[model samples]
Target: MFKFLHISLLLFGAVFATCARAESVLFLNPGSTQEAFWVSYSQFMQAAARDLGIDLRILYAQRQPEVTLAQARLALQGGDRPDYLVFVNEQYVAPQILRMASDSGVKLFIVNSALTPNQQALVADRADRVGSLVPNDEEGGYLMMKELIRLHPPVAPGKSIDLLAFSGLKITPAAQLREKGMQRALAEHPQVRLRQLVYGGWTQQRAYEQAKQLLVRYPDVSLVWAANDEMAFGAMRAVSEVGKEPGKDVLFSAVNTSPEALQAMVDGRLSALLGGHFTLGGWALVELHDHARGVDLNQYGGRDRQIPLLQLIDREYARRMLAMGATPDYGVHFRKLSAKGRPVSYRYPFNLQTLMR
Candidate 1:
């Protein structure tokens, strides 16, 4: 009787441990289903969640702030509240979500778009706020502009390289950071005269229309810098409509790893493309998985981890990426990227090289 009772207790403990290992993560995607960048981002994250044995749920906000808030409220208030919530600071709506999640006891992790310093102050005391994983947007912006300037050297000695810039919404933190980086690069190169900087609203149509008007307004603009791929493509179209060659007459540079952008790079239409930050959501999953398994996330990079995930996708690299196709097989051993059982010195391989490997 004593032996049987001991065995039953052991089985109960084993079951409890298994249950503890299971965790659910809710991802609030800030883009529509048809949006290429966000769709790819969620796909990569789903692959990671599968490998880590995490139950991941995604809710799209269709790029609307009100929809995002509404979906978040529904998810949080539902009887089946997720154990963790991963979100982006899209259009400056993170604070409200953070407060809602904190009140409901759901651990929060911000990805892609991180909170500003002032926004962080609002939830500084919330221990349930896990951390943030964001790319160095400013670095990405600065690099894209620097390359554009390099590719389009002045026609004459001391000639101003006229440029037209397309930025996203000013209220978005990511857009603000990217613009800040562009400004830094512009400041360094005094001859690169920015004729005008207009908000493209992150849509190809709006960017196309804006480009049409801006191109005519600034005909001497030899350089065009867009904050994203869609806007870049729009600007390219506008350049072509205006009887100027895209890659030849007016050089273009932008961010994001959409297949269209990669193919454009291959075709020599896009002068520069910086990307690979879509893996942020996947990397965040790895961190959360390790944290759930008793790994101290603080040892890696503390609460707010800003990683240099963006890299310049040259022609050769662009070809390699394109070969992988639209829904590229991530083929990543997500567990290998975790810090759960690794040494203290083990660094997380969170870059394009990892994806290529």
Candidate 2:
């Protein structure tokens, strides 16, 4: 085990050995666990929690900001004081949620979504905050588009490739950041024309309906980009139903390489997928564990650290990830898995490492 994690575990052992009370964590998920995005996140966290001997409670906001706020309030009012509050900021509820955690003096850790500039400044000096963990979404967006352009070169004599985008909720920060990245790529490539962009609310069914409408409106669209894999899957179905081959006549690209989506990429259905973000929630719990065990991640570093993305540009990488399967055990690298834990890296960099099996 790394020195910092070893010290953390020693502290945890010493404290629990005397107290014998289990540590509890409250996770405020922005979406439902039934969704592919949340399903992977929750599953990984569950595995990590079981190994860490921590009591974990997950509350879904159903993609509603108000529901998140209500659930957060209800959790705070309960008898047990959550040692850590692991949350995702959606609908701009970060300020209120942070305020609640700050007033209650609970350790706060954010996942999936980054805080606004103002919110970050507010918590910059707070000792109870462990910072946010987010995927390189902007970079993921840029890479997907860049790969698409590489695969399908522009036609000669100033011919342009028409493009359409299926975005998540416009209000979500992750969606906005991804769109900005897409726009940046588009700006660089004048040969790619963006016909239209629509919000799919981060769901496949919604994306399917919206993509069908967009395809009808602009049947000449050449490429369809989705903010997430589920939406990409939906867009592929719509493109196929409209009598167009997904990877041939029209192309598809997205982020978050779910199992089905990764297999689809290997099968030539999706063009590109940048994944490994499903570990955000689980990783946050790991950080929180260290923080609760007397390791000051604050003294160690700042917030909004970016975890590296897994780019499955071809079948080889997709097959490697598929072999890793559902229960990702990346936590073992950070925490001691046995009496003798493996060497770990405590420095939280944006692109820490390539998460391959």
Candidate 3:
């Protein structure tokens, strides 16, 4: 946001800017309990806020829009009448949330989900919304599929290839978008057969259960495309339990570059990963910070509806990075502080950083 780097002048500016009295931010996620992604999100925002000298509050929900809406209303009535309200998604309960934010005069930022065009109309164009943030979930799917194709090409003519696909939450847009990305790859490579697609709900236990069931149902499945890294890790465990080498026997691809997931890829226990939520979460927090500072999301080259960076790190590359002991950062491959909201590749001046193990 480039606002108030000098602490001496910060108090004076703060008092006059209406933001002087310590700005508050309310972060609402669907899951009430802390999970992997939200943990990273909380850590990222906490650090970013410290750096920017702002206060950001955290809240949890049970994957219900109602819970988020309730929290939004409570925030306004409480002492934390935050300057901004951020939600994991705004689709299912956008109307309710928009009304609450409007009543409270809070800035809105959608991280994982957004309002539909119809819902947007209900917002009366005063939704307090800045913009939305999401991991390149679908783009990650595309990159994973591309890697799978590279590893395994159709050999025999009309070869009936079998694959088991694991989906994220059945109803989330991420689940659908990831499914479509994999489907796009399958269409081009006729040998990559989709035999089963089970909803894993983004949990290792559920994914493991589903993997066990799919193994029994389709024993000859060639590859697996998990909607998320955790699900892929679960399937990897199942494959190992069944006396099979995961990467060597049946290639696996997944999105969301969790550190453990990337380590598995390095160990050759899992194959490749596409995109990641860790850095994206931090980046989104920064964007929201700017928005709360009166910066319009449409300004400063907005990344509206445009594809974010989609990283397709393979086992070899992951291994190299891990070997070097390099921890990736939010701006790992991103060039410049900001860019126009457009899909750009990291194949240029800023190559993937290799750690020196």
| Highest-scoring model, lDDT | 1
Comparison by lDDT, 1 against 3, better one:
1
On a 0 to 100 scale, what is the lDDT of residue 133 in model 3? 60
Error (Å) of candidate 1 at residue 282 is 0.3
Instruction: Give the CA lDDT, 0 to 100, for residue 234 in model 2.
Output: 87
Which structure is stronger by lDDT: 2 or 3?
2
Instruction: In model 2, state the lDDT of residue 121.
Output: 75
**lDDT string, candidate 3, 1-357, tens digits:** 346447658777767775565567778867636356556556656655665556777887756667777887798666668787777653366667676666667777776656656666666666556776665666667777878777764667866778888987766777877788888888887777899888888777889988887888888876899887778888888877888888888888876555677787778766667754544444566666555555555645453443354577776767664543333243232223333343443111211341111
> How accurate locally is residue 264 in candidate 1, as Cα lDDT from 0 to 100?
92
List the global CA lDDT of all models.
0.88, 0.76, 0.67
Identify the leading candidate in terms of TM-score. Answer: 1
The better candidate by TM-score, 2 or 3, is 2
Quickly count the clashes in candidate 3.
5
Ranking by lDDT: 1, 2, 3
Q: Let me know the TM-score candidate 3 reaches against the reference structure.
A: 0.80
